[model samples]
Target: MSKHVAYTQFIDFEEDVKIRARDQARVVALREKKGWLFRLMLGLVLIGPGVLVMIADNDAGGVITYAQTGAAYGIGFFIPALLLSGFIAYVVQEMTVRLGAVTHRGHAEMIWGRYGAFWGWFSLVDLVLANILTLITEFIGVTLGLGVFGVPHAVSAAAAIAVDVVVLLVLRYYAWERVSLWIALGNLVFIPLALMAHPHWSTVVAAFSTWRIQGGFTPAFLFIVLANFGTTIAPWMLFFQQSAVVDKGLTVHDIHHGRMDTAIGTVAMVAVAVALVILTGSLVHGMPGASNLDIQQILRVLGQRLGPIGEDLFALGLVEAGMIAAIALTASTSWAMGEAFQWPKSINMPARRAWRFYLPGLLSAVIAAAVVLIPHAPLGFLNLTVQVVASIFMPAAMLFLLLLLNDATIMGEYKNRKWQNIAAFSIVGLLVALNGVYGLSVVMPHLF
Candidate 1:
């Protein structure tokens, strides 16, 4: 039995190396295929991890953040700011692409192997806890969206769980990536919903010119700004993208495609976020008693303003956003755990072979779904707490990411340039400061 187990491990390792080589060889073949149109098609096929990560970043919780931003502040400040945030997200996430391609290791593995166990465990625990909490929010979004269609919360959650399980268990890595990209593309539903709102095009355009706040730096305004920033990039994003790149078998030669994938995703993410803000901003902004409207209330107002179809479409977008993010977050947790513990990890593995690798993510989704089924769960508070915890941990995650990216031995030619480090550290500084203020506000409400 021991010898059999060793044989299995040996087979898995050999298969892993072959898979990586195949990925690199495929890229070489595509490059040698010649025609621009064929290369374009090949590029599209290669687009997966980066696109998935960015869109998933604009999750259910993120939708709510954008909604609140628009409802409170109109289109002024946030629209263009979100676009800039997309670029910032790209800049940071781009490093993960290079790191994954060069090392062929997940972010967690790099930290554990290079930086030592203490930091490794710290990153792993932070990612797992955040993923769990964020998964709960995804379930909440699913339930809330489906609730509008008269589905019971339990049914909605159960269905979501089933879908997640099927996607993870039945699909290989390539199929899973393609399926996820298709689902993520559905996030465009928000664009039509925004159009349905009949927002003032001029007002939306004017926002970029002014880039000014309507209310001028109130505590409430600061809070929403931080929320937007926090949602745009998170610690899980770093783990998910790097692991995904590795799992997808990306190599340094394919880094350009990966960067393009991430760029496209960043645009999609920001566009969807801006659309949600516009949908709420145009319809509900400055309406009587609109200041404190939650997502349910916002949906209610949407129904009143744009009829049942508009409301239903918005709800559908919410459901898609939640499910897509749930998929990515679940996979992130699984990959992180597998990398940290040196377990076999691949979406391509058969269920029997990779059950241990897949179990953590599946169990997390089930648990989160079960929690959402409970009567009167404090979902709103839980969602806010997820964002706060993400902000608190963002600095540490970025620290490791920077450290890894800067390591000349590991990254070789892919290591961070001086400008990359400067920009990354600057972003980290801002996040740390924002987190400090946010923490203070939570701990001492009167101070803000």
Candidate 2:
């Protein structure tokens, strides 16, 4: 009886080993079968949130700011400055990735849970309000762009709203991200427009070497620089990217991928900004009375210089910029409200289940659209107000971000390094001073 038992045990152990070997072989085979196409698909799936935030950062406001920079300063100092801002943007946003992956919490939720109601509501209100105002600017860009092709403002606003609704309602989180990424990719149209302008390559190369401002550091020049800073790193971006990273289901293992995604986006965003500057700089820079040209006038100048193709492409870029930003800003608002209130807070939730989460964003968009359609609205003042509000709210947002990143109870092994903290603090200090200056300039026009 003992011998029979021993033989049976040996047989069972052999069977277990064989089973283990088979499973291991299967896993290896599956891994080996993952070809370049498979890897590519996987990468695409992992790359949406960061890319969306970066592209959305290059919104209508950003495009206008870059165009204005090129038109006014002619790419002397702003190009390198934009490149540096891109790096700063990356540094700041990378914290969002780490925070999201490690904590699986949105920025608003972190502020609320870690701090208290006051700071939480403070951040939430600031984000939602900024989002609404930014949405208005986006619609304005959309209507203006479409108006170039004879589409009325009402029709354009309606179309933009419908598109936003369909994208949010019909798609789950992954699908929504993928769709938004494709729309964001449309922003690359500015590149060819830059080429069409036929910029002098030698001069473009020499600008960086010289690194001199065309008009020196005048008050107007400083204002544009601050505008560039404001547009590049907004409160909405922090909310949007963190919530997006969480919603996208990224884990700590995926942090490397997230960083790659953000870096790629940074390059793409800077490239587009530089291209816009080059396009407008080549055509509109130093033109008679062109220093203060609005976006419409900039497009008109493009049409005049490069003809209809140039005009149409620039218009298309504006439309894409506005559409992409609206998608991100609306979603950012929804996510922040959901996180703050502890509602069903995912784009993956079906419309019926997540209506509460979606309502705030939808309402904000609708209100913004309605505002845009009103006859003879003070759009210039409204745009300035957006910038000013963002400036006022920026320091608070950065403070919360820094606090959360340094919270050892939350971040564990992934907390901010000393260098990162130093860099971030330096950035915050500079932004605070700049925002103060900008605020004074806006409120008291003669201060600068």
Candidate 3:
């Protein structure tokens, strides 16, 4: 009688244990489903900064430059020339991906700490001046583009200032970046616009394959290429991406997604640049000495060839480009200033913790907006001002970036790797020498 009772009790215990195991499996399955949703959301959240950085990298200046390159050279050279530096961009930008992931520091802070105040102040001063002037140009772009749409200069400048303020004030970094990424999508319009030009695909193909140079590769072309490269890689991009990574709290684990984000960004930029070239070349090739085009002239050309709709679209795209760029440029100014001052410098930080960090960006944006709308503002002088200053300061800026990338103290194991340094230095040397030759050509007249 006792043995039968004990066996029955053992069966009861076994049934209870099996019920618990089944319940546990269901709970595990529920969590697994939740994880998939969480990751999808995070991936969307993680997408913007890299892409915005890349899109903004293709600023109004770049659009005009690519247009001019195609108008002058007919895409024979830069189609492939653009490809060469694309991975150079991918490789160079990838390092910032790692730096931001590992250190969670902005470029200013890294240089300041790794080298000293001397270099730190140097970088900060350069960034601040370049950023201010560059920001003014973005506003100029916005105003010019809006003018084509019949928006008055004073009204458009004021509206642009308002837009920048609202975006900076209302959103946390996450929301701000996502909104900006949507704005950045305007640049994609160039792809359809470019295709609408009815370019001979075979001609585009031949241009890349043959690598033809007009009148056989003059110094002027070299300078133009160097400037294009400069446009591709800027000091602010390094600062902006790193600060963005730090703000997003990207840690060692997120470096994979960050690098992937950067690769995607690199592709977006190169594609847009190529599209700009094709758009200009298809419409304006073989014109009577039509190489010297600028932003305002590009609109005239678009209006002439594609009718008012195409002209309006290009203007709208340019406005969008300037808007997106203004956001990044202002953010970069804020990040670098905050880092240099040792103030609370993160977009992730609560407002109180980082208001000092955020204030300078707001002020700089305001000043830039004001200056753009002033009557008889010596804008032609300002246009020359930006180029002269950028030319004067470019070498120093590139030197600091190279120095920082190579500094084992900052980058540690992630230092520029030998081959990367070769490309970097080669780019730097080429740019420097091209400037020299350009100056000579300008003075000599016949050499170019």
Best by TM-score: 1
Error of 1 at 130 (Å): 0.5
True lDDT of residue 389, candidate 3: 54
For residues 1-448, write the lDDT of model 2, one tens digit per residue: 6633532332233332342353234334444566897566556657877889999989887888789889988978888888888988899899999999898779998888778789998888888888988899889889999999999999999999999999998987767988999999999999999998899988889888999977655668767777788788889999999999877767787788789899889999999999999988899999997788888899898999999988988888888999999999999999999888777788877889779999999999999999999999987567655765676677789899998889898888999999999999988998888877766776887765
Displacement of the residue 46 alpha carbon in candidate 2, Å = 0.3
The TM-score, computed over Cα atoms with residue i paired to residue i, of candidate 3 is: 0.85
Model 3: lowest-lDDT 10 consecutive positions: 7-16
Q: What is the lDDT of residue 437 in candidate 3?
A: 72
RMSD of each: 3.2, 10.0, 13.2
The candidate maximizing lDDT is: 1
**Residue 186 local lDDT, model 3:** 92
With a 3 Å backbone cut-off (N, CA, C), the pairs that clash in candidate 2 are: none
* Full-model lDDT for every candidate: 0.88, 0.85, 0.76
* Candidate 2, position 401, lDDT: 92
Displacement of the residue 294 alpha carbon in candidate 3, Å? 3.5
- Over the stretch 31-123, how does candidate 1's per-residue lDDT look in tens digits? 889899879977977899989999998899998888888998889889998988888899999999999999988999888877778998999
Candidate 3 lDDT tens digits, 63-175: 66677778878878888888876776776677777777667677887777666789889888888887777777778878988999789988888888889878876676667
Candidate 3: stretches off by over 4 Å? 1-41, 216-220, 349-353, 375-395, 407-413, 439-447
Rank order (by TM-score, best first):
1, 2, 3
After aligning candidate 2 to the native by TM-score, how far in Å is the CA of 372 from where it should be?
A: 1.0
